[model samples]
Target: MTAFPLLLLALAILSEVTATVCLRMASAGGGRWWIGVVAGYLTAFTLLAAVLAQGMALGVAYGIWAAAGVALTAVISRLVFKEPLTWVMSLGLVLIVGGVLLIETGAAH
Candidate 1:
């Protein structure tokens, strides 16, 4: 993938991860936290659309986006919320990364 679309995809992943984290925070903290959730998701979707418009295949783009989001969210949540990050979970993350890499590479064929 080109740098621009990849950059947009990265941003989209970050936005989605941030939004998911905000959602959890909002559940506990309430109030203005909801704004972060909304803004983050909006930004994420917008960037995702831009990535698609850049001619990225949906399967590849979404695979990368979702896998990265899940991994980042899990790690971030563990750091921020003291949530568990067990060995099994870590293995799953590694597997997810591998899977996304496969999807991305296969898309080139």
Candidate 2:
């Protein structure tokens, strides 16, 4: 994919991750934070839609999106929430990244 579409996908993943983090914080009676949650998800979906308009296949785009979102969310969760990151989880993240790379490369062919 071209840089612009990839950028959109990255933005989508970041937006989703942000929304998830906000939701976690909002769980403690911070109802106002739900606005952020809504905005983030909406922004992400919009960007993802734009990416699809660019002709990226669903399997490749969504596979990369989901993998990056999960890995980034886990790392950020550890930093922001004092969540523990076991070695196994680290391995899982690496595997997720590797799998996404494989999907990306396969899509290029």
Best by TM-score: 1
**Every candidate's CA RMSD:** 0.8, 1.1
Q: How many backbone clashes does candidate 1 have?
A: 0
TM-score of each: 0.96, 0.93
Q: Enumerate residue pairs that collide in model 1.
A: none
Least lDDT summed over 10 consecutive residues: which range in candidate 1? 25-34
Global Cα lDDT for candidate 1: 0.94
lDDT of 2 by residue, 5-102 (tens): 89999999999999999899899789988998999999999999999999898888899899989888899999989898899999988998899889
Off by over 4 Å in 2: none
Q: What is the C-alpha lDDT of each candidate?
A: 0.94, 0.91
lDDT string for model 1 (41-97, tens) is 999999999999999999999999989999999999999999999999999999999
Angstrom error at residue 14, model 1: 0.7
Q: After superposition, how far is residue 70 of candidate 1 from its true place, in Å?
A: 0.6
